[model samples]
Target chain A: MEEKPVRLDPWASAVKLEYDKLFRYFGIKPFQEVLPRVSQVFGDPLHLMRRGVIFGHRDYDKILEAYKSGERVALVTGFMPSGKFHFGHKMVADQIIYYQKLGFEIFIVIADAEAYAVRKLDRKKVIEIGLYEYVANLIALGLEKNKHTHIYFQTNYEKPYYRLIQMFSRKITMAEMEAIYGDLEPGKVVAALTQAADILHPQLEYFGGFKYVVVPVGADQDPHIRFTRDIADRFENELGLRRPASTYHRFQTGLDGNKMSSSRPDYTIFLSDPVDVAVRKLKRALTGGRATVEEQRRLGGVPENCTIYEFYVYHLLQDDRELARIYSECKEGRLLCGPDKQYAAELLAKFLEEHQRRLEKARDRVLDYVEPPEF
Target chain B: MEEKPVRLDPWASAVKLEYDKLFRYFGIKPFQEVLPRVSQVFGDPLHLMRRGVIFGHRDYDKILEAYKSGERVALVTGFMPSGKFHFGHKMVADQIIYYQKLGFEIFIVIADAEAYAVRKLDRKKVIEIGLYEYVANLIALGLEKNKHTHIYFQTNYEKPYYRLIQMFSRKITMAEMEAIYGDLEPGKVVAALTQAADILHPQLEYFGGFKYVVVPVGADQDPHIRFTRDIADRFENELGLRRPASTYHRFQTGLDGNKMSSSRPDYTIFLSDPVDVAVRKLKRALTGGRATVEEQRRLGGVPENCTIYEFYVYHLLQDDRELARIYSECKEGRLLCGPDKQYAAELLAKFLEEHQRRLEKARDRVLDYVEPPEF
Candidate 1:
């Protein structure tokens, strides 16, 4: 059978995907191949890496090599400040905090410009969300405020960084941009070039000199990664820019088994969601259970397609042995949906209660971390 | 006979025109209508305005009203540093100095980014030309170093200026941009928005406060002026931007009677050109002398078509009485091309010698005026 072609769009709210196609068609190597080296180089890999949540990569091997050699490496990522910060965003924050602990310099861009232009969000509202929601949540999640950790609103950045966007425009053609992004508009063109600058500015001499850069993004953002890599190659000799390494994580599935997004608030859980509210949502999530108890006992359960199990694997259960025991119990039909949901709810409630307390304090510290843009 | 359609292209190097189409089709009012008012409002008018060289305007009456009412007013213009600063650029420098002397705030943009991205000039060379040629010529032409006079390289501007470009993109569509500028590319899109920002940024609260703005440009730049006016209207409530008033001048005719440009070295005189070399080029200029001298005296020469007469009107002589004498003498065929060329060369040589002396000191003072981008 002939396979359908895949096209990734960074701007899409919910992207349906066959993740394996990323490895086969887009030259993204299976990230599992480098899992062992990650443990050896960084001394116990991130939970996402170990559990295979970060399922694919472009040049993560180079990132590992740079880490092992004690070379300067930086992690770059961005959040579109169009909505509330949710668990899907936390998944990225986890990767960023993990890299920061491993001594990678962090550059976080709050994409207020993209949110206002492409997403048509209110400018003042976008800036408010970027600060109180995104930056505050990252701080609550233990994003350190060191000299190496730099967070900036896209509109309020340094001159050299904006210069990169202007220089990159000369090398790429419109047809090439249209291929990755379906249609063109002035906003999208500027946003795309701005994104390239976000990913590659660490290598410019004006931005601290050269460093190996890696971007941790969702699978749907590969188009931006591919476009940025092409730009890096074209400017290799002139700007001394190298292709940025990237690892693509699978989307955090919503309670309804769709992609988790702030736009779908009913199924998604915000980090600041009240304890009872978050727990109630989790209790109603679809799980891996059969219709009849007799049938469930006879044919076990399918944890592979379960949203409840995904939450435990991605966030709640970090111990390998405990997570494995739960997996086996579900597979053997020993743990029913009702009892398993109750346990997941308790853990989720505890996590939200503690996070909210820290988030309250974090809100007051956002200005100390990054200055918001003045309208 | 039917009139041909007119399309103004800001990117094209040479544009042919029948000037009346701008007034009839594009709604550009004749500057002559406001000439007496300029003399009444700001004192003796500029030579260019008096001689009808600055032939058209859009909302210039508003600018005069703002100035007369003791409201803040600013003059904005740009120089694309693709090559040397020729007499064509000095014309703009003259207007800038004229406004500065009138106590109007001045904002001069060194379009280094546009030169690199649109003209495909070397980045380093563009910066060099912007400093040594463009900025130096403005300084030599007596652009005062006052608080009101601000100069900047496009790539190295402030955060709010770049922010305006980002926000402006939201309201404009690709189809709209392509309508004004045919066949779009990434660089041109950014350049167009950047130009709008250049003209309108003086009114932004972050730049200073709201001020009445006027741009002096050649006829080919009408597209940018029109585009910026539309942007100003769209952002009127949000950004508090008023549409900038503008006056359009006829392009300086080259010695060969084409558009005078830095790209056409033999026909265009650079402010930095050695006295002898500039005079040699001027001596070989095309003229309006009749085919036979006997016929020239009977049917007077057409001063309207003579390049030598243009030099006398545009530069060389600022006195209206002396310029009118030369025009009538040439029209009566009493002055042949040979003697006229010698007189114009002497004037050209004298201007270049004195200007080059000031230019030597001006080049050393460029850093005080504006900062260039570090690549």
Candidate 2:
């Protein structure tokens, strides 16, 4: 069933609303270009290339160098955890898995504190359900705990991050906020201020001080990425902290002609979806080609605007030349949207099945990595 | 040299300046009655009373109750290692000793961070001088390191006090400051709020919560005390933390009739002062009666205005009856200001003598009590 646009928090600062500005700032054509570079930087040792799917990145090469230098770069991601996980959850989980093979750390924050502060969660339940949801997914992702990733909530009060917050509060002048938020209304300024604190919090103490941290987020969360990086730059000098260069990756879209969101079940094909259910979902996938074969032959298709291609750009196939071949053939009416949809559906099902097997085997091994870090 | 009366900060609230209004709001009397009650409240338990002499308190009696409850309440007091010891310095040290006997945990924050924040403090000299000033005095005051007090600075970021600051900031409303301190000029509002965070930061954690705390301080510091108590009151219902109290005392003035400040050498007699030197200083102390004994016999002296009685009142003397007897004798000119001064001077010498010996013996003992509290 279709519904109206979600009521976005006016203070939440939408990522999609600032897309053009961000693209111009980063010198990227669009988010699609950033996805392909993930494979190159991650080092295609397994070579998941079927077609050119992923696109562009910022400082992807720098993070790649860390791997070459034997310094591990962590793939840091987070969940708001206000609700249950769905298809988009599995998509990000799969993305984390790809990086784990490349020997990167996976740092996942449940963001329970953020969720509680923002959405007004009952403090007691904030961690309970979310921690379970998170650990289960990480287990399903086949993440080996201490080695591959750490899934932690941000409610740790005794951490040195609290000290960093104290110090951070001293450095930023009211003049800065007056210029930016314009006399931040007291209604919830601390929460807004804490958003900056969250990204920089991990850098202050013994979390291998300021190494390459990549935030893998959906395109909608780009505002947080941009805001956090700005805070990191200012805080780095203010704190005299050893700050490593950071980058943000934006995932493309869903099966429908819109952004992928957990709340929108129809647009997403979850990793756990049965093969028949996946096929039916893909049949409804939005395509860029002209309606009929007669009209499609005369007019080239708009693959760039197609949501299916966007998903591939963020996830599935990786070979650039193969993607180019498919696009060109479709434009020339050599390959139709229906057949392409079936290929994507089958490809996704096979990947999911293989992932499920890996997840089942790696579940117990993940617990050790989740423990507190020693100094 | 005497400096000009310090000008109040323009951003400070009118209500904040009207310390009497604060007294009324807190259901406490004006500072006049409050100052004298310092030692009287905790009579006999402490070897020497340093109530009005010590003068300022954060939560003086709540801490006493906490101490009496057989709760671990270390007396926490301190000074920034600014310069050599003075009489005003001894006032605080004496108060710390009183609380130490009452079985409260004592923490002496050298205010090193405060020194750095307010003025330049040489890092190399800070810890050294702060230690010499506090550790020795604390020992002389009968502070057993294992039993009495622990002295530290604005410690590493690991301090729980920083966590308390964070919690305090979230609860206090900016409107409360506008009400308490009044209108602030542009951009100064946020920094105006940091004082509440600084003064209220005491590290005490309880069973999934926190403990009661107190600060004994002079009336002049009521601004900080009010700010901190406001923060505590603000968060009392929200965070489930105990509301800390402030014990306000009227400070002892210099022999020259000004605030008994360490900044002036003569204003305070150092606990480290030699017995003969202390007696000589007392001989020169300001007197408020007739010049000659016979001339003063017809005219009653201002015993209420006398600093000698203030000392006896502050440092626990034989009794209040002794103070009343001395007051009657001085007012009727029977007890000349000279003899009265002589008596107090001798009392102080003996007091410091015993305290110095105890301090030397208790040096290593204080170190053990200062260990990080177990949660």
lDDT of candidates 1 onward, in order: 0.87, 0.55
lDDT of 1 by residue, A20-119 (tens): 6777789988777898999889898888887778888888989999988988899999999988999999999999999999999999999999999999
Please provide, for model 2 over A52-102, each residue's C-alpha lDDT reduced to its tens digit, 9 standing for 90 to 100: 212224455566677767775777776777655555576567667777777
Per DockQ, the best of the predicted structures is 1
Q: Which candidate tops lDDT?
A: 1
Summarize candidate 2's per-residue lDDT along B116-205 as a digit string, tens digits: 333445544655555665665666655555433445555342434543443444445557657655643222233334444444444333
Model 1, span B305-356: residue lDDT tens: 8888888878999877777777767666687778888989988888888899
Residue A224 in model 1: lDDT: 92
Docking class of 2: incorrect
Error of 2 at A135 (Å): 4.4
Question: What TM-score, over all chains together, does every model reach?
Answer: 0.95, 0.70
